[model samples]
Target chain A: MSHEPRDNPAQHREQREPEELHTPIGWPLLVVFLGIIAWGAFYYFHDLLSATGATSEAGDRRSVVVVDPTAKADGAAVYAGNCAACHQATGMGLPGAFPPLAGSEWVLASKDIPIQILLHGMSGPITVKGSLYAGVMPAFAQLEDAEIAAVLTHVRKSWGNAAAEITADDIASGRKAFADKSTPWSEAELKDKVGAP
Target chain B: MSLSIAFLLAMTFLISVGGLALLVWALANDQFGMGQQAAETIFAPGEVGEVEDPATPSAARAVMQNARKAAHQASDSEELFERTIADQSSRMPVLFWLSSSMVWLLLGSVFGVIASIKLHLPDWLVQEAVLTFGRIRPAHLNVVAYGWASMAGVGVGLWLIPRLFKTALVGGHYAIAGGLIWNAGLIFGTAAILAGLSDGLEWLEFPWQTDIALVIGGALAAVPLILTLIKKRVGHLYVSAWYLIAALVWFPMLFVTANIPNLFVGVDQAMLNWWFAHNVLGLWMTPLGLAAAYYFIPKIIGKPIRSYGLSLIGFWALALFYSQVGLHHLIGGPVPTWAVTISIVHSVMMVIPVIAVAVNHHMTMLGSFRLMLYSPTLRFVVLGAMMYTFASVQGSMEALRSVNTITHFTHYTVAHAHMGLYGFLSFVLFGSVYFILPRLLDWEWPHAWAISLHFWLVFVGWGIYFWPLTLGGWLQGLAMLDPARSFMESVS
Candidate 1:
């Protein structure tokens, strides 16, 4: 074999394999990079830690039922002010931009489901009326528990979707569930999960 | 759409596809494993006296002294020995890619000028379907930003990165594939917009399908670059490589997240839209231009960078400050006062990175100012580096709430955008192109006049676009701002 090493003795050849090489700062930077990445991952998923709300124990209307008419009324007005922008005033939507709030299972289910959905946000492929709606719902977790409660109550009643009326207590309960967590919900992971308060 | 518009769109797609396919063919054939040890070989005597009937070495020296033209033809140049992908890649391919980019840029510029004037002369180009300012304006942007600038950046990056690292490209095929996919996205997106099917979000205006295509292309281009860097034999990572890689990561993330229906929902849309729009400038295009500045300034002067530490400062500060500062775009919007406050804070705090880069570039060229006259690379790089400072200051000034109220929806915004995109980024790209094209192609520019014409066309034309006209338009908007008068009456 013609052993004509073009320039200097290469460390690559001396090491015999590419895997033997290392970044100059070695594992520390790689570790720091990993740490940064891990922190980012934790931040992305932090919502799961603080996730809480209604506790459903089958056939219990208390969990899924609306007790206060005033709570429902307040929720409706709040929903009109906030949620109305995307879902639209008529509960329809701007077609592809925002999904309809009317008759949405995510919006109408147990108060726990909508509460969590509102707080931390939900993402991915969802089915409403047999049509798969892929949308990103931003977290309204920043809003007061009462505001979230009122908005959910409003969406449930005002829209053609009439389910359980959401009370502030229901939402407040949900807030205690994931007090320390706040990552946006990934659609695939939470697709089959229960609804929030 | 008119036949010409249709034809232009189709031609753009065809050119992008062909260019991509050519790169893929070259990569698969190991064309990228060219004479990457250029730096090592650059110092050699070359093939001057090494021909079959060798000319005397002294005779070769004398030949070199008299006229470079004769010496260039007579000397069996190092080009005679070069035959890698770098060699086979050829000048025509590079020029073909570059000229296509420039063509798109010119088209975009013409459309933009019309759009600017059409604020007052809505009847001028509003008569036609495709020629409407709404359609033509975006078509212009697609051509210049995506078609011209991005394509040219990739072309130069592909050629330069591998050469600098003295490495054979392992994933160049993926880059080619990505380039085609990206171009397809641009064409489809531009066409959809021109068809009045735009999503109507400023900068996030493209439809979903186009968005997906662009992200995929970004991944393809990024994969090869990441691979090349990993396999590189270089001892130290250059500042230029850092900027190029950072852009690759930034562009894809912005494109994917911005267009995803699930991520940017409702109220978040306004916030996310500005985030993506600014990054496309700060993260995507700025990095490409900055990389050129880092490379050309030092390379032209034949010295190490003035301070590698400043380069590091510039890179990280940009990452930290630019991302946080996007909220400034929501200045007058109802998106919360805190967000606006943070954006303005970071926008002004942007001085750190800009100054770092200025120090590095200016100090490096401290004694080399004389070379600006002799070297085209130095002139363009200095021009771009200085413009970077100017644009960043203006960007900060514009982000202030009081200033934004006067300029936000006016032509001043357009002028600020032109200053950053064209004034800063385009000039840097031009310098990089001048420096790399000759090295990549083994042949001198066949027609220097054409290249000079291209530069003058861009620089001189921008004066007309931005200087007095854009400023006057903004002042006129401010005059129309008094609360006592009707909107129409004030404007009139």
Candidate 2:
């Protein structure tokens, strides 16, 4: 096979190093070139504006808003999002800082006392499960009545604590009762109002 | 901020003026005067369209040359040249570098297979800390990238530059020394990695001390190539020479800058790491692969490239676009939005050079498709050329924000990377090695069937390796994107 090129001189001319012809680039290539450039330039500016937060909700353009008109507020999810960081997912609060919500008389004792505490918040050293916890619990007054009620109800039933479910009506009444109290409440003040739980 | 703006303006002015000055100088010197005649410079007297192989008798070639000389006197200075002098000079260093690279290639593949197995069976190699998946994976990456791929690229360049320049390699001894030094560095680096003494960077796992060794070795290797280019007998520089020179220039700068200790931190480090990593492919491996493709494809088929002008555009555009496209890997990361956006844009713009290259190779090989059956070099090289187009286009797609949002941080990205590096770069390297070794060793392949066997094994193995993984990775990306799925479910 290798000898055939040599056997016939006209069959195979001597091979040379690769060369390039002077052919012109066609129109399809030109179209692709122009199209990519235009698209790239447009995408850069458009996505850059949104990515830099130049518009509302532009940080994540894929964040779709799902407005569920008939949806119920999930208390477990609310707990995970808001309270689980300090209280823990197991409802077991930190040893000395955060008070435990599970199997605690403060949460299961009286529904109104817990509601008042949630609405006004508490700062002074409070007793939970016979231990003193001095950390402050922030006011959840911003949460809807149903959200607050649902969260309290969730805490009551979890972690071996059996208690009646709190209703939105109960939370609404608690809000009305504490409407004038603008500041966080002391433990003593709460105990006095609730008749020493 | 205002000072930076003024500096940038000054730079812009300087570049424009410099470019204009170069154009004027080029025109005055009649740089483009060679015209169509310049393309013929690669061929020696009576060299075009002739079948010259290592196995072919020199007496026959001399006879053919005399016949051609008698028929037409194209140039008065044209004379019969002996390629034996250059081939003999290149024999030692090229063989040494290529053989060492093959050793590393085997070792790297072993490490890669181990890592892949560990992904499926965690307990398979857990007895030794050195063999742990974390250590094994980086070792695989670094060994293949720095040892196998880089060494092979340099080896090819060392042999090719001399061939293209039509000169004996001036400092072949230095290249041999460089190969030894390079292997020593790889040994230390891979050992250090297994022993948990890594730098903790992705592509830069080797410690700074080892990096210095690599830099020195690379410089030593580059000396012969530069000397050969300087001592070139040919007046016209081929397209392959251009790409090889650019690769040699770009790689050291990237390696040195990226390895500087404590220069970058946090997001800047990430950007630098990716920039260096991606350029290792784009500037280093891609150029080497393309150079081989440009040379071997036409050399095998006995034809010139389709478009000279398109080749120029391809080379310059690749330099312009590939340098900036690295930052696209950090899209949606904490880096500045504008920085990533610019990278994405450059990545998309890569289509210009890619298309230019694609057209040049495709159209050159258009009528010569049948030659692939007779030439094993053509088969692998053509596949490599095709994959270069496919991988680069897919890379452009992957850089888009819409595509990246799903594919980023997924196995899909891994598959794409393999497509570029192994599919495109490694295949080209394989083809080049096959073509080069025979010439260097002065031996024809003992069996044609063995070559076919090797080609099919690699080709079929690659298909089995790539397709299922690509499909699985895409599905994995989709599963991961959905918030409704649990982690276990997504992975499973």
Top lDDT model: 2
What is the per-residue lDDT of model 1 for residues A1-197, given as tens digits with 9 covering 90 to 100? Answer: 12222321111111000000110222332354334334433432232222223232333233354577544346666766777788788988767667787877667766667777787787777666556778888888777777887677677777467787677788787778877666777655455554432
Q: Which regions of candidate 2 are displaced past 4 Å?
A: A1-14, A48-197, B1-31, B49-80
Displacement of the residue B102 alpha carbon in candidate 2, Å? 0.2
TM-score (all chains, Cα) for each model: 0.59, 0.74
DockQ of 1: 0.01
- Per-residue lDDT tens digits for candidate 2, residues A1-197, read 01111122222232556777866657677677667767765775566545453433225545578978667677898788788999999998998999898888888878998898788888978888899989888988899888888888888889987899999999999888767898888988888876455
State the DockQ, from 0 to 1, for candidate 2.
0.25
The residue pairs in collision within model 2 are A13-B49, A13-B50, A14-B48, A14-B49, A14-B50, A15-B50
The global C-alpha lDDT for each of the candidates, from Candidate 1 onward, is 0.64, 0.78
Instruction: Give model 1's TM-score versus the native structure.
Output: 0.59
Interface RMSD of each: 18.6, 7.8
Write down the C-alpha DockQ for each prediction.
Answer: 0.01, 0.25
> Which portions of model 1 show Cα errors greater than 4 Å?
A1-197, B1-100, B485-492
Taking the tens digit of each residue's C-alpha lDDT, what string does model 1 give over B295-322?
Answer: 7665544434665445655687677668
